[model samples]
Target chain A: MRSLFHEELETLSDELVELSRLSARALERATRALLGADLELAEQVISEDEQIDALRRDLDNRAIDAIARQQPVATDLRQLVTTLRMSADLERCGDLARHVAKLARLRYPVCAVSGELTDVFAQMSEHAQAMCLRSGEIVSAQDASGAAELQQQDDTMDRLHREVFRILLEPEWDGGTQAAIDATLLSRYYERFADHAVSVAIRVVYLVTGVWMDEQEAASRDHLGGGGVPRAGI
Target chain B: MRSLFHEELETLSDELVELSRLSARALERATRALLGADLELAEQVISEDEQIDALRRDLDNRAIDAIARQQPVATDLRQLVTTLRMSADLERCGDLARHVAKLARLRYPVCAVSGELTDVFAQMSEHAQAMCLRSGEIVSAQDASGAAELQQQDDTMDRLHREVFRILLEPEWDGGTQAAIDATLLSRYYERFADHAVSVAIRVVYLVTGVWMDEQEAASRDHLGGGGVPRAGI
Candidate 1:
């Protein structure tokens, strides 16, 4: 019974990790669609949103069922609940991807963001993608170091997001105000996606380490003058 | 031991319902601040957001702990999992409330949504608030019929949301285009709030009736006419 229960827990983890992989690809495709102005890919992302939604629902149900029927104790139960929460975050990430695809449709044939701004967005997308990939990796392997790396990647995305907003607010940009505003909102969506990825990573860290690394990191940073801290930051 | 387990489960449910109530109030107060241009209330809502976040994180840990320690049976496991998901949906709903409060801050002293459009937004807010309230009621009472009522309220919010979009897209309204666009996104945020409320209500319906109402409703609608169906009419 004990081994069977462990096997079931492993199976649940495997399914959740699969959903994370699907979610990562969805975001990547959405970013590609936005950058390349590919309506076909955008439409595909929009349609596939239902699949992501279905997977999220399925995973939640499975996690709940596993917890109930198997009567999983302690760490096993934590794993199931974490899977449930992560599934919702992944679904929202997919929703963000669909929102990006909607923008693609709105600004089809011509990219909404152009030139230097486009480079910023592309970098932002790459950062978010990396965070998503790292998050999934950490969850799959239960690697605290990988999860920590994912959190750092989110900081880079946040910095880039601030830069994107600063450019949008500046009055010097003479052309494409509406498009820039749209891109501004798009950047926020991508930034939030990265935040959610980091959120998953934080959970992974907590799952393995049994401590809220972000909170502890923040506390440590505060104690160290907020900037002099090495390798420890929220 | 069994009674202790039941007591913990009951406390979890009660705490979640209380959190839902607190969230609903925050959303309502934030909307009121917007419609009335009450900055003080908006500030209060902003401050209260921290409490909601704290409650969310607390409930999250408790839910995970419950699953970990209790080894709940199938239905109970589903309940715990649903509670976990509902907490997330609730947190996002709180974020939307904060978004509304921020809009109130940005466009203060004067109601940004003006003239007939103001009336349209007011109606939308009314419907959205009603959904939020009904969702809380249903959650507290575990009333399936009340959950269905909340679903109908969401349908009303969706209709008002579409009407707001229509006004924004009209060619004649160009003077306050920036404000109009902001209002457009604001209405969307509220509409999405209603959507999340409906999601929560649907989960309540599932918990009470052991039937997934949304899927069944969609199936019936698809068979009936293959066109847009009113969610309220379901």
Candidate 2:
């Protein structure tokens, strides 16, 4: 009976990982639709959001059930709780993707962003997708070092985001103000995506090292102000 | 042993209620400081954040310990997990309050909002604080009806938020752009406060009813204009 319970707990973890991957794909596809101005893909992403919601609910229920039936202790309980919290975060990411896709579909014939900005955004989007993928890996492997590296990975996306702002704010871009707003907001979405990825990485770090990183401690560090966005309330 | 476990779990629930109450107070004070432009009060809110953060971490650790030691069943585990998630939400709400306080301090010298609009915002703030208080009550009592009332409570905040837009866009407010921006952002903060309060209410509804409120169902009812915010996925 104990072994069976262990098996069930393991299954719960696997399901959570699967859900993470599902969200990652949704983010990637939705972002691609945004960049390519692919109306079909945007519609597909918007239509598919319910599935993500369904998967999230399933993971939540199963995690609860695992805790009840398996009665996982210590690390296992932490893992289940973390999985549940992470699922909530991931589900919101899916909603954000849908939000992006909806924006794309709403402004279809009038693509506000130029190809130049799209290029920069594409790079940001890809790096953010990579973060999501690595975040899942770190969670599954519980790798502290890899999790630490996720922060560095996010820095690249941040750089690209700045590049986006630089291009959008140029004096020559007067006619593009509306598009600029859209691009800026899209960059925010991507940045938040990376931020959530970093959150997952921090959780992975906590899982392996048993040392939860606090933002207050990090804030105390004298920063050279290299422009890395500080995690809020780490 | 079972009785001891139940007792410890009960203590945890009590502790969570205490933490939630503290959080609601912090939010209220922060809102007041923002609306009244009280820099001293804002500073107090900022300084008091450490206590709130510490309480949050304590509640978190205790919740983890409870789950680890007691090994609760599904229903009990859901309650525990919900508490953990709600604690995070409450902490984030405190963070948002701090955010407002930060803005209040930065935008010092108190720009006066238009008379009628300012009155509306003051009332909105009161309603937000009330929602937070009611949310706490519903959580503690596990009162589904009270929780559902939060949906109604949010409408006032939302209407005030829209009215803020009208105030800002008025032709006479030409020089008030910056103040308008500040007010709009402040409104956003309160709007989100009410939002999270509704979310806590929905969670309570879920806790009691065992039936999760769907976004569509919420939209049909149209309380928060589709009430609950989407859960963020990992």
Candidate 3:
């Protein structure tokens, strides 16, 4: 019975990795759709998000069933609960990706991103996709070592997010109101995508080390200029 | 043993209601901070968010303990899991409120919402607070009846969100870029706060009726415009 529960746990972990991959792909396609003004691709990302949502529901049901049937305790219980949260983070990532796609669809052939801001967004998209892929690796390997790296990547995204704002705020800027709104929302989608990836990685770190990563710890380490230890908190 | 488990569930429900109240207060104070440019109130909201986070953690731990100790199945298990999800939604609502307060802090002494937009934001804030309060009632009573009312309030929020965008996108709009960014983020924070409240209410609906409220169903009903029945989905 114990071995069977472990097998179920393994299956659950595998499903989580799959969800991460799906999220990464969604973000990638959504970014491509935004940059290239590919309505079909944007539509695909929006529709495929339903699949991600379904998979999350499936994983959640399995986790809940395992808890009810097997009654996992201690570290095992933590793993199960963390899986539920990770799935949620990943699902939200998918939604963010879909939001990006909807923007692409909304703009259609015109392209939501202005010419000056395109490169920054391209870089942001790449960083977000990389973080999602890395998050999947961390989940599959159960290795928290890569968690810090994900935070750094998210920092890059944040920096780019600020840059986008800087461009929008330029006094002589002429990106029009529609372009400004589109750019603002687009930047946020990428930034939040990276944030969710870091969140997933943080949960993996907690699952492996049993040390809860509080917001202040993550904020201090990632946003407050680094090298700070993860503060101990429940 | 069963009676003891039920008693624990009641305690869990009470904690969730308390969380909703905390979230409502956070939004209230955060909005006041934004409109009045009240630095002290903003700081209070920011610091007090830690308490909300801690309460959520405590509630989550208790739910996990209940699951492991009682090994609840079927409806009982669903209730416990739903409670966990609702706590997360409420916690996120607090975070959105915190984000609003941080904006107030970032623009300290200078209010985020410009003169023309202040009334819209004020109304949005009030709607959000009311939704949070209603969500608390739904959780405490396990009453699904208020769920529709909560969604209607969210619709009001959604319309206001679009109105904010419309004003920003106007051709003659002269709110400086800083004000625009501040308004954009502020609007989103309030909209998301309402979204989370609706999420909590939907969970309460599911907890009572066992009829899952999928995103598409809610979207079709809310976005697709009135009288649409909730479509069945897993």
Candidate 4:
């Protein structure tokens, strides 16, 4: 029975890795739809987000059932609880990706990102994907060190987020106000996508290194200044 | 012993109500800071967010302890798990409130919001505060009916969010790109603040009605069109 319970925990971990991969693929497709103006891909991504939500529901119910049946304590209970939070982060990643896709759908026939800004968004998408993928690896391998590196990964996303603003506020910006609003929100979708990945990474650190006496303690050092995309003062 | 476990669960509910109240105050003050350009109030809201984080941590630890010591199953286990999720949502409400405060601080002497849009934001802020405060009441009273009403409150916020975009995109918009960007992000912070409140209110609905077979089932109906902010197309 004890071995079965541990095995259940292991399955939960594996499923979390699966959630990461699902969100990563969704984000990749969403970015493609955004950049290429591919209406089909955008619709595909929007429709498929429900899958991530469903998988999360399954994982959550199973985790709760395990806690109920196994009566897990200490390390065991923490793992189950942490899985719930990680699943939530991954689900939000899917939602953020869907937001990206929806913007693509909303701006169909016309590319949402115009000109040199497209390159910045592509770079941000790449970095966000890497963070999401690595979060999965960190969870699967139980690598506290990889989780530490994932925390740093958000810096690139933050920089890219600020770059989106820089372009939006530039005197040469001809994209007009609608584009500016889209870019502001689109940049946030990517930035928040990375933030969710970092949230998952930190949970892994807590579970692996046992340094998380409080989630806030680990999180205090964890802000990549990603939360607020504060301009250099207007 | 079972009664003690239930009592612990009751305390978790009370604390979640407290968290909702904390975030409500934070949103109220943060909106004040944003509209008034009160640098000191912005700083105060930013600094005071830590207390919400700390309270959530305390609540999480106690819930985990309740789970570990009592080894609760069934309704007891679900209530504990829901507490954790509600605390997370309420904590995020505080963070969203802080984001609003940070934007206020970042913009400093110059008001982040400009002209007519200020009225829209004021309405959004009031609506957000109402949802959050009502979420606390719903949880404390275990009022599923009130939770239903809280979900509808998001429509006003969504309308206000779109109004922010409409103003930014209009030909008459004199606010320029920097203000456009600030308004976009600020509108999102308020919209998301209300979304988190809705998230909590739904959790209460689940626990009270036992209708939450899966969180996504209820959440599918819960979108409020708030996630994407899709435009009328470019």
Q: Second chain only: TM-score per model?
A: 0.84, 0.86, 0.91, 0.93
Model 1 ranges with Cα > 4 A deviation: A1-4, A106-117, A146-148, A163-181, A215-234, B1-13, B35-39, B57-70, B103-121, B163-181, B215-234
lDDT of 2 by residue, A1-234 (tens): 778876776676666567667777888888777777788998898888788888888888888887887777877777778888778777766766776676576566555457678788777777877888787777777677886687778668767766765665454654333354456556656766777777777776776677876556322211112222122111
Model 4 DockQ, alpha carbons vs. true complex: 0.60
lDDT at A147, model 4: 66
Give each model a TM-score: 0.79, 0.80, 0.93, 0.95
lDDT of each: 0.68, 0.67, 0.81, 0.84
- Cα error of candidate 3 at position A191, Å: 1.2
Candidate 2: residue A183 Cα off by (Å): 5.5
**For residues B71-103, what per-residue lDDT tens digits would candidate 1 score against the true structure?**
677677677778877777777677777777766
In the order shown, the candidates' DockQ scores are 0.18, 0.24, 0.31, 0.60
| Model 4, span A148-171: residue lDDT tens | 687667777777787887777777
Q: Is candidate 2 or candidate 3 better by DockQ?
A: 3
Q: Per-residue lDDT tens digits of candidate 2, residues B73-168? A: 767777778888777767666766666676666655563344667687677767877887777787778888886578877777767766665565
Q: Which ten residues in a row have the lowest lDDT in candidate 2 chain A?
A: A220-229
Models, CA RMSD each: 6.9, 5.6, 5.7, 2.2
- Any residue pairs clashing in model 1, and if so which? A74-B68
Docking class of 1: incorrect
